[model samples]
Target: MAGHTHRQLAVLRAAAAGHVEMTCSREPHLYVDGLACCDPTLGHQLAGLLAPEPAAPRGPGLRVPAVLTAAGQAALAPSAAA
Candidate 1:
């Protein structure tokens, strides 16, 4: 997963918790719908992370969005000071 993707997912997931709506393009690009704001490079990074790994290869090119897993979220919550 790309580092940018991880950051984007982190941002999105954080927003989601606050009931902020988001949208993912057909290409799986994420967007902050109403806000009409997003960092292009960050979006690409996030998309790369979210992409599935190739069936035969391993390593880079494996888009695995570093979306916060439930456990990760729980861990982050306290630090978020929310």
Candidate 2:
């Protein structure tokens, strides 16, 4: 969690729970708990934690299906154990 802040961890946890969504755009955006995250770099920060699903016919800026990666799951483990 060195590189991840509280908000970042929350986003990861939400993603792990399938409560997060992202858009496929030049600058991808992340939405947590059905609400948009104001941070523009949120997608980049969580890139390592996200595994994109198969390519879909989504228009620019449309929602892109994604799943949490092993790293993402691990990221939330410490908190869960606490």
- Model number with the top TM-score: 2
**What TM-score, to 2 decimals, does candidate 1 have?**
0.31
Instruction: Give the range of the ten consecutive residues with the poorest summed lDDT in model 2.
Output: 50-59
lDDT of 1 by residue, 1-82 (tens): 2222455546556543542322333333333433533654544444333322224233433323224345435434545444
- Which tens-of-lDDT digit does each residue in 12-72 have in candidate 2? 7777677877887766788777788889898887887875555655777788666788888
lDDT of each: 0.40, 0.76
Clashing pairs in 2: none
TM-score of 2: 0.73
The top-ranked prediction according to lDDT is 2
Error of 1 at 61 (Å): 24
What is the alpha-carbon lDDT for the whole of candidate 2? 0.76
